[model samples]
Target: MKPEIIDHLSEKQIQELCQLFQSTWWAKGRKLPDVQRMLNHSDLIVALCHHSSRQLLGFSRILTDYVYRAILFDVVIRDNYRQQGLGKILMEAIINHPDLQEIEGLILFCQPEVIPFYQKWGFWGKSDRLEIMIRPAAETELLQEKAGSLMN
Candidate 1:
């Protein structure tokens, strides 16, 4: 069956999204409340769903100013649906999305090994003028606070 791209997600789809992220090495053990907050705050969320079954095959989101810049995040295709080009389908949806198409650029951070996959979609890493930087969250402190709360 052909897959359809959708911008809005139902509560069930949001739960599925939480589960999908929880399975990823980068986001393993991500909390549902955190996922819900992310969804609530994002500029856009898109998913690929089976045309017949309507099962969510892939998911991703963008945080954008709609005119100047956009960042892609939480891009994942369900494990069972990988290697069938669903990723490309999802990227195309993002590229053509009305709210994103006029932006100056789209950016995402992926592991070094996955560069080729994104390169095919016109995202370049070799920029003479641009560099990527990050400030990671304080995981240990956050975890301790969470545990401390649970014990109360």
Candidate 2:
């Protein structure tokens, strides 16, 4: 059956997506984002593939501005649905989406082994221009607290 791509997922759908993420090896044991948090972000894009009966077969999202840049995220297919080209279909739909077509660039961070899969969609690592950094959750909380105090 042909899969349908849905742009907006309901709260239930978001929960299902989180569950899917948690079950996967890549995201296993990872904390899921809250549904309200997902909805509050204008740049968030959730693409879901559903069967004729409306069962979710695959999912993906992009964080982006319509013109400048986009970060592809959470691209995955249910274990049973892999190897059927559904991943390609989902990625193509996201990359060629009308709202995303004008983007100057798209980015995603994947493991070394997954480089070839992303390369198929034209993503390349910038060997000379890349600097990776991480800020812990405590730092994020401190920032949020400072911002809250300034607002009051």
Give lDDT tens digits, candidate 1, residues 17-87.
88888777666688888889988999998899888777788999999999989999889999999999899
- 1-152 in candidate 2: lDDT tens per residue? 56888877766666667777776654554445654475457475646566555666787777887788888877788777788888888888887788887889988866677788888988897567765544445657555553444233
lDDT (0 to 1) per candidate: 0.83, 0.70
Worst 10 residues of 1 by lDDT: 143-152
Model 1 residue runs over 4 Å out of place are: 126-129, 137-152
Each candidate structure's TM-score, on Cα atoms with residue i matched to residue i, is 0.85, 0.78
**Model 2, C-alpha of 94: deviation from truth (Å):** 0.9
